[model samples]
Target: MIFEKFGKKRESAPPHQATPTDDSVSISRRNFLKKTGLFISGAVVGEHESEKFLKKIFKVPSAEVSPKEAVKIMPHKEKHVSAHSPEALSEPSPEVSTETSKESSPLDAYSFLDGQIHPVAIPTGELAGNTFSDLYAMYLGMPNGTVVPETLHVDFKENLATLWRKKFNLPARSHDERVEREQLQFLEEHHNLMNLAEYVYRSYDAKSPNTMTLEEYRNDVVGAVEKSRKVFVDTLPLVPTSASEDGVFSKDKISLISKMGESLTADTLMSLSFTELMPLDKGSANAQVFGFLLRNAGVDFIDRIPSVYDMLESFGPYQITPDALSPKSAGSWATQVLSALPLGFMPWNVDELLRGKENIAAYTLAMLNIAQFIGTRNSAQLKCLSEVMHTLPSTQRAKAVLSFVAAAHHRPHEAYDAFDAFIWSMYVERAHSFREEDILRHIPTKDLREYTGKALANYRFLASGASVNNST
Candidate 1:
């Protein structure tokens, strides 16, 4: 019964082909057979074993195999039959098989299995997902008609005060307090010159309006003269002479010089009839007398002179007694006094009153004046004007200079020329003496020009009724 069953199974199996020698078989084929579970114990069946099995089962001879055949077939062996039933291999359900087929088709399996496969998933719709552009726009987009806020401008003087505090080693106080303290110190030190100090203090005071019309300034001068006449008594002789060859003047002579000096304290020097101090002919006896008096007055007396001169200069416009004092003589005198004074006299100048101080009103007026000069292209005015700018801290200096440049560009020749030849000449003197490079060093020329252009455009836009926030 065993032989009959084996014979029947051998008849049902396919015919075996001749096998190639082990050496002639390729590594790929050997690997394929091993992977497919066709080999027993991971090794190829021996030709002898195959032949023996075939002969025993179907009575076939090994010599009958053709040399051209390469495939070798083995007869199936009956599995061990146990007394108990065997468990069947588990199979997927129909639905599970269908899902697995869809998930891993021949193409997918080939892609996964093949080394040279290039696969790409095809996009199915226009709006596949949020793209980078869409996401970027969503994050960055602003609503239509959104309004930007106007840029607030800081006062240049405040900027100057802040910068001054930062750059210089000063007392630990607010800028305003420091300024006031200095002004008070200046006043206290020169108590005799209270009137001139008061005038300067008022000019730089934040509470006072910084500007004055020519008429107003002249009227103040006249009032100052009357006030001085009331408060100061001129007791000394008009002319005093040296009593000795050493050039030491008598006490009465010194007293007279001191009284004449009082003219400065009273703010009456500007009001003095030019006849009283003029025609300063280099060779004249009167000029010689005046020169001697000034020389003998001592350094302390000369030190007080610059502040008085600065007060007179601050008036901006005034008339001189042409017969008594030529513009040339006035200029010469101013030059002489300026040269005689030390550099400390600089703070006494009207423009420098608020140095290391907080005086926005005065700073604004200065800006206005600088802007006017820029439009005029009056290098002389700009020259003198730049002095105040030079005194500012670096940041404030740049800002003030740029503001001047911008204002000039914005309103070129907008106003008629108000300064006369003498005034222009005087400014030319001061301007030529000023070191422009000192201030220009703070800002690049190109940046200044660009800033001017932008400022002009802004001014034009504002003039046209466009909002500054939207102008750019």
Candidate 2:
């Protein structure tokens, strides 16, 4: 993305200007102070003091004065030369062009972070290349129209890392330690589901054997699924059908039975009626609710569960529950719950889905399924989710998906914070007036609420005039 700087032609200085003299040709204090405005006090300076002051002001080498010094010498030569006029001395010296002065001025260049501006030093040396400028444009673009070099040097890297740590409210730790701490926090939160949680943790951990290769990572995930399956099977009742066919009637089943009664004759109803009817299962109810909401929201669901299951299974390895599944046995059961919407549903307007409790539940269940599938932190799964999220109609829903993914993963806090930064960048280009809090408010998921608070606090810290330069 880097662009090469187009070299602009410069006008040459007029030949009438006098060449600069060496330090040996010293001007008196009165003449020097009047020309360069380096007057320390009203008192007159000696010859040696004038030389030192001139050298300091011009930043010239001991052996030679810079071209700017030629202007100071021109004033003294007024009586000697009629061609070298005062106007020539007033003209911008060749060495100090307007563009160069503007580039070096701190007032002309600033960086934006969460909508606040901070002065940035102009880059120099190899760092002056276009790569850094493109990087800034890609990530943290300049809010002001001024073009300043934004390089990736030691200072810039330190600033970014410091900003990241401050946003997360994390203590000073190496990247490895931070990852470990996050993993441990995850384990503490999901201790009851340690087998699956640990599998996800180890799979994503940089130090683990699971990350040694793609095949190794896949094998580890499969092993975790097998372990979870064993636990589920061991706890299962001896007669599965008996438990499934319990006499308790679900609300939907009760409504159905009541409707059937209305169509039946009194004698026929008495003979055919059973003492108890099994209620619709929780999964069926969720599916029914999901279908209803989707239909209401203008989505046509043709064979919701089957179609959705097919799509979910195609997303590589996903285990809805520990039960036997397809597309690499570790597939998720939540797929059936999420499948209510058609596969081609992209740029989906989820505003309608946020209206009612049933819609929320259906959406939550679908997200939960997606979270489970992504919990493994498999690269392929993340890539797929990223693609799907981008296809979402609005940035709000994309952020919601990101928040859900973060919540379902091992490091929800870190994930949420990172996405917050991303969201800020996205809005910077899309809506200049929209603040980070404004964008955060639109995110539908509660999972990101706490993280959003922390992120805002960090932003406030930056906005409160706590300087990035002051950070360690």
Candidate 3:
């Protein structure tokens, strides 16, 4: 799902500083929000269970929370946020236009971007899809094309590679070449989509406000659905047999979920959360969503949750501003966490990952990116790792948490930027809700820098397959 890079950085003004998307709005304040935090969730998504992530995180009767709340934030009128905001990240548009506009602009092309993954739309034949194109047709609840139930059976990896070849006009090849070239092409697209995701969040989600019009809403529906399938689907491994930790979701229910996953992106897989897919009541909507995500992202995706969370905590565009963060800050530490992924000790630069890597290097690089962190960490991210563990219930703790302190990247102060204004801090004075004891445990009351250093060194050596004697 890697898209070609746009020439200019599509900078959006933050709400306070926002200019009008149309003539109706005015803005007095804004910032560029240029932060270099890591991306938490690496793989593509937007499935029937999209809302389930939040539900699982905060178990309760489901509120009317939008499925992809992270993508479209309604306006919050605090000192930091303004009443007049862009639906871009969000402040709802001042007015609603139910009827289609008399004319349209280039932005109209992104109409498919409604970005929720509810209805199932499977592409057939030698067709196409992209983030800015038809990728989100199903999510917009305006699925197009002749979708047969059989499309559910296509091989996820092979189909993606097929789409890559057809898009580029690369000739069909023998088995050996298909194994080599198509695999390489798929990896390249994988890296490319990561870059584009960064760009999309940095430019649009970070700064510009978005509007929801009757016509524009229609397109956002389609465009967002397309974007998810094209972007995250590239990173998923093949789906495993869908089952809960205790195996609650039945085969028939799992099949329906598989169908939903496949329709969204021509595969069966599911992803997100720690411990428990949800209650097993076969008729429950929550149960169905859990089953759907399980089928769409595959079982191993369960372990990858923290790694993806690490990326969101560290690299998410809204989190860090290079200048505001000093060298000693946790933001720098989060950057190191990216270098220390358990996938291997390759220092991954997003630019290098997105370059002319149309060979094995692309696939290998993605392996490191896609591989789970296994709760690994250097001194830099140890507290953040512990926080992630704390975010989970003790009952939900599994071997995944036991593998903690291995390798991951993220900083606490910078990580909370999305919750507050970008004015986040290590002390977190504004976040009164976090328990004092919980925060105190991770914070080093007495210096244990030596143990911290050794822990990081040992883990890196172990993760990289270096011998104990190689440890510093």
Candidate 4:
């Protein structure tokens, strides 16, 4: 989910939206980028360069549909690797699958591959294939993933240590030179993700006939992690760590909210990002590890990066949902404001979620606040959370809270409506099947329960590592 942003709603009411289509009225890329608020780096584009100078766009569908259509083309229709673990589902499209290493890969893994520079026999995934490892197989040029993302991350670090080691010369908003010395911790933790993204770009550029590259890859990745990390750390004292823990954001209580595309399943539109929180001990390296989760949770590599489609739906790795900023979502906004008070969020801090001013921090806090509300012990409005929370082990409740947050992220009030249906199912006739209208919300996902259930089980697998890397 990079804590991918898709959907959110206060009530079980759906946010009105036009269904996306591949062929229809089109908007210019410049206007679309402007509307998305991601047309950053004027310096990169400058005064005279053609729009082609902007690399953010990959392939503009020749037909030129709406910006929202971009979300539909890729993983939106893609299925999970397996129904079991993150990678364990049915076969994934080759680019997203995790493949075992060849033991000896062709020295010709890339167009850039040459004899003097041997294809380093790096650690590859146990399963079939994924972009991260594919990028890694190309990063120094090697091979990544467990649907159990840890398997991905574990070997990810080993496989692409070269990419992971890349760092920034300085932070985005570099302070005084002396102040920069004090911010060494930030330097060590936050800088590498964007740099790795840069290498991921070059890796593809080095490809035989590169099909795609998001020139704006750096801006999007930076928005997700770099800028987000800086703000998250500054407000570390104010955010809540977990719903279970008292509202204290500290080193000892690190509240993690992750959006892993890998956690997405068949029913859950592959277009949407899925979220889960896996706790890690807080130490000097805490934020850095959290950064890794934030990165992979949404779009881990070059190809998966949020496209122009993500421009309206969600932004950043945290998948910053629109409801937080949408004026019509006042009720949800109000609840967030009132709930966030005890945690000491200022008016601006709360506004940051929707404004896209501070990407990840706002996204993290927004997701956490929603998770906390959903995880609240006796919320009558959120019996879904309470009911699910009861069935889970104490350790798993946080993951469940986040799963619902993620499910709801893609479609407004989906989790709430699904829960209401689930709760009603307890009283509904247990016959083979009943009237679709009376029983289902016409969200069109008649199998919403199965989707949410798979989500819960998928996340459980993530925390448990039960299947050894979300693989078959």
Estimate the TM-score of every prediction: 0.16, 0.16, 0.22, 0.33
Query: Model 1 misses residue 328 by how many Å?
Result: 10
Arranged by lDDT with the best first, the candidates are 4, 2, 1, 3
Off by over 4 Å in 1: 1-163, 167-445, 467-472
Model 1 RMSD, rounded to 1 decimal: 48.3
Residue-level lDDT for 148 in candidate 2: 31
Q: For candidate 4, give the lDDT of residue 129.
A: 39
Candidate that beats the other on TM-score, 2 or 3, i.e. the better one: 3
When summed lDDT is taken over every stretch of 10 residues in candidate 1, the lowest stretch is 1-10
- Residue 12, model 2: lDDT of 39
- Stretches off by above 4 angstroms in model 4 are 1-304, 307-316, 321-403, 424-454, 466-472
- For candidate 2, write residues 182-284 as lDDT tens digits: 5335323322222211112111111111112212222333443333333322222221111113223334332322222222221111111100000111222
TM-score of candidate 2 against the unseen true structure: 0.16
Best by TM-score: 4
Provide backbone clash counts, one per model.
0, 11, 53, 52
